[model samples]
Target: MKNKPTIAIVAHDAGGLGGMEIHLNEMIMRLKEDYHVTVVASSLQVTDSEGVTFIKIPVIKRPVPIRLILFAIFASIRLLFVKRDILHTTGAIVFNRADFSTVHFCHSGYLKATGGSRVSSGGSFFRKLNSGLASFIARTMERIVYRPGRTKRLLAVSNRVREEVLADFPYMPEQVGYLPNGVDIHKFKSIDDETKKKLRKQYGIPEEGHFLLFMGGDWPRKGLDLVIEAFNQAAERFPDLYLLVVGKGEREMYQKMVSPSFRERVLFTGKQSEPHHWFGMSDIFVFPSSYETFSLVVHEAAAAGMIVISTKVGGVEDLIANQVNGFILNRDRGEIAAALIDILSDVERYRVFGERARARVEQLTWENMHRILIRHYEENDQRLGQKALS
Candidate 1:
């Protein structure tokens, strides 16, 4: 019998929170059965990696600049000596070139979009300095590793991301591939009314209100301010409307954004480990994010049978048909408020929206995504005169 080919995946963190970490975890689980998987990360949350080899990349937790630079140096040094048939990584975390690199977010594109002030815009002097330095390091590394031959293939998380990659590196159109993130359909299952009520009570939320969920960290970037203002406006007409804000952001700062009268109706659950339950507890998912490669929560929301109201960012354009399964609105508060009113006005008729949304994302399972990823790996392998590893 022939030995399985070894595959190396490098990242700062894997099998943990956030979209990119979760994507790596999903790929690791599926790839381990057929290949010898080696995960090079600072921290890992995957416990099922029985046959997988773990290479720990020591890094500091605080001060983003130190952490980023340390990981890049150490991880790159380790990659130089590691033996593997294929190499994969998320973004430009290391100095060494990779066989496959997943572009979760285009920092260079973001800098251009936000005029080189995305992270260092409104923070303290030290915060601004740290973020600015971190951004500089990441951009410099990205520029080096995304050159024409630095990577074999660039797996973009969305069509939006694919465009960003091509815009930044127009020379590598053939090397960039559109590979949107997949949702775990089973984990984010729809809940019945009884189950929803029970969950609301468990979370200390009122059981008798129409819930509007705004999830994700980075309150400003995810448009929580828009969601809060819009919810305030919508709450005026629909008295039963309630808002649920999840993820770890500036809670006190955003709580002030809510109208005084409607403040009591809003609840913030700080940083949930399991967000699938939160999706099941809400009726509508609201996101007015300024930018995203692909918001995994939106797909999870739709999978959990929630009417998704979001801006035209990430995979949303591909997932939503206007006024059909969801509403792709602008970042304006009035537009978001109006869309909320339109959907909540007729709950019974609009209930079909969630059903249709679930149906739309039913086929976008991790297993399906894994198959396509393996096919890509094998195709790239064939081009390099390697045996089929699929």
Candidate 2:
């Protein structure tokens, strides 16, 4: 292995406070100890403490077919000039390079999967037009980027993501590796009951109230509406039960979902800078998301020793065992409500599950993730070297 491998990471928006940004930032912070990392991003929204160099370039959110072609051309040219051993693109778009091994980290293929919900800055008409245009652009770009005949590795954040990648691009199975996102267990450990009560008081949450915490950005995809419905159904049984949503998204849309009777019980804390504080105050962590590659919030909740209730979707199955560490229910609202009631009714069982969840998540820290990533980097580098000799 090289003493210090030079690595280049590419993402659409590097600074945005989302799952991708969180993953990238954690990886960058850890990888900088062993590798010289450079980040090439479309938009630079956050600053890194590590001395990794960052290059900002224009990225098209809804580029027409012609503009997308130009974007790939310019991106490839820019990438070629950066002398790096590995070209790691954090999303779906592959980078073409014969000399260096390109790694594509699959986030989502929303453009290819669901082409209808594309949003644009130019308003609704432009957004709808952009969706149609995006499909063509994505298809064209994929063709050019993957046509070089060099087998580039693809990293899937979850098994679901790997299946999606295979379904979308059948010819690249050999290049795909499943790497689920991890959480910082040390930072999210359970607080004492006294501390939890203090935090609840600070947040204006009743000390005895059962607070259901939902943490994520895309409220719709995270099934906030379904969560609201389930909470409403369960409210009659447990009057002190409240739903606390912590993340960034359209507030008006979520507001309309809450009935006037339960309006006081629903609290929107917006995007939290440090979410562990809120997690400390929470009674149970609930995630009813319909779509997710890997739900990091579930892991975070587990680490915090909170009773986790999630839909059996995405990478959750890998981490959560029903009635063991956490409860994973079906997508139906009734099933979710039943699970919530069952857990709430049995305090001893809930504590046992929460403790088990914490034990399971204690192994999934950033330190462990860093080691695994480093191994992948070194192994891939050696494989590339062998290919060169062959």
Candidate 3:
């Protein structure tokens, strides 16, 4: 252990159960064999994880800007004495003093999508004021972290993300490494009829209906509204169709969007803890998100042997084989509805697609992801050492 490389993973919520945090913890677990790992988080819940040192930085968590700035300062200060050969951060906002960072999503790309860009900032006075200020700070921080001669490596989770980062800051293309996200193939297992029936009963999804699933955090950004619109349009033709959305967003907003006759057919599970069970119970997964670095749930759906219908966003192409495994489309309501109709229209096609989806995802595992990450860990550390000596 003493002879092994010391790696420090710094994130705002390393111990949290969100997808990024969970993957971070899993990465820590996997690297423990050849490295001494430590996690620096804002708040941490101690678990039976052997060989991990959790450093919690006390910080308030209301109003995200304050939390980000405070955590960045605290974590930066704390890193001064964190004896480690390499430091990995989940986000660029915090602890810019790092060897490498996992570029999950580019802030500049998100700002462009959300209309928070410097040139085209729009909204009410207060909204614009807040947005402008936040954007300025974030962009400034990003520029500093990604400046030329900085020598910090960037690990992009997907090609789309790498492109996004390079689009924002054109010079860092060579410094960026392409790394994709992975799912636990074993956890996203297909279930039998009995298991599906039990899950449907537990979630109040009618056991007899053909289920359409959508899972994401934000309704607008994740294109939950788009899914609802498509479902509403298609529900009229297929009475057995049921749309089950498991996400964190305005349920009432979407509920009211659905007509009185179709409201009952739409069910919002309100952020499920066990997504595998939801995926197992689902027939088809549909998500038309506006922008994504790499949608992890899409991989989970394919791994669970469900036919996926997503938009042409981010690294979807890496996971989907177009007409073979899943249907990747633009954000057209008619096109989305038509794709759903085609899948439901043909039983044989649906089965083949699901089978192909499962088979395609079989190669995507956490072990593979871990191996790639660890390789980069050593590469980045060695590169930094060479630069220091030069």
Candidate 4:
């Protein structure tokens, strides 16, 4: 093997749409500096970088049992052709026992964290069936692919995910590593205040309104219903308050769910090209998701000096301190209302929290996350080397 091992980053999802895609893109851009990185992704429209090579493959979009199994079969065959020392699969994919495999947990733990019953069915028969089947297969695959007998490592994005992995698969605790997802803090910080205002005005938002932004695809999981409810109750108190939702998924369904009185107060800017501007325009970031492995939106919100309000899920607790940077509440409507009211009532406190939130996230840049990921690669490389010698 060469001194700098070849690293293959593979995912079964399209690029730049979801949290997994974001993390994969950030990791690929950063890892290109030191390692020979090649990305094998499902159909996506991403352009290739200088040193990174992206190969497109056909795979099923839905996370169904049969589809995932087929994805694994195709990925295993593809891996056989690629020359790499370590094969890291994000999301969920099983690799041959002969290769060094690392699976990063994003949503697998949320099934347990929120308890199975609270998970949203999203009113789709295929989705419901896929969720149940995926849960079962995930449990079974963890045992078969990451067993102590198999030489592979598991990377969890948060300590919570690490706990979930240990609790679900106790034998693999020693094989797991905790690496949180990071944001491009510089991209957010470099934007001037004038640009932020222009972006807000361009989106039809008033200059002085207290904009509350929610950015995510899974509305039910991210607690958009609760956000709308809380905003409805609090809207009468603060007339200047407005809600901007930036993402696409079941928009018509969610729009029907919103009360007529509150409909005008809320705006849905579907799938933004530049999401950072929405973060900049908003005075506070509100995410009330009941289940999350780790929310990149909260990090992005905090990086843009927006007071973050999220539930205690995944690694959210690590990034936020109640009444310090932002607020953390239960799924209760009353609690969410109270927290929103508190932030809306005290502008000075909100400003203070926003500054603190920005300061807290300054250290969580992509560079820092890449450094930690490289450490994991180096550790794995050394262990593989010693095993080869022994």
- Tens-digit lDDT string for candidate 3 (176-260): 8977777888999788878899888987668887899999776766777778788888888889999888877767767888868
If the candidates were sorted by their TM-score against the true structure, best first, what order would they fall in? 1, 3, 4, 2
Which RMSD values do the candidates have, in order? 1.9, 4.4, 3.8, 3.4
- Check candidate 1 and list the clashing pairs: none
TM-score of 3: 0.90
Return model 4's CA RMSD, one decimal. 3.4
The model with the greater TM-score, 2 or 4, is 4
Evaluated against the true structure, the overall lDDT of model 1 is: 0.86
C-alpha lDDT values of all predictions:
0.86, 0.72, 0.78, 0.74
lDDT of 1 by residue, 69-156 (tens): 8998999999898899899888988877778898998889888876667832355889878878888988988888887577878989
Per-residue CA lDDT of model 4 for 43-108, tens digit only, reads 543435677767666767665787678777787788778887777777456565533343455344
Candidate number achieving the greatest TM-score relative to the actual structure = 1
Provide the global lDDT of candidate 4 against the true structure.
0.74
Alpha-carbon runs more than 4 Å astray in model 3: 45-47, 113-135, 170-172, 381-390
Candidate 2 similarity to native, TM-score: 0.84
Evaluation by lDDT, superior candidate among 2 and 3? 3
Q: What is the lDDT, from 0 to 100, of the residue 387 in candidate 1?
A: 38
The 10 consecutive residues of candidate 3 with the worst lDDT sum are 114-123
What's the lDDT for residue 180 in model 2? 68
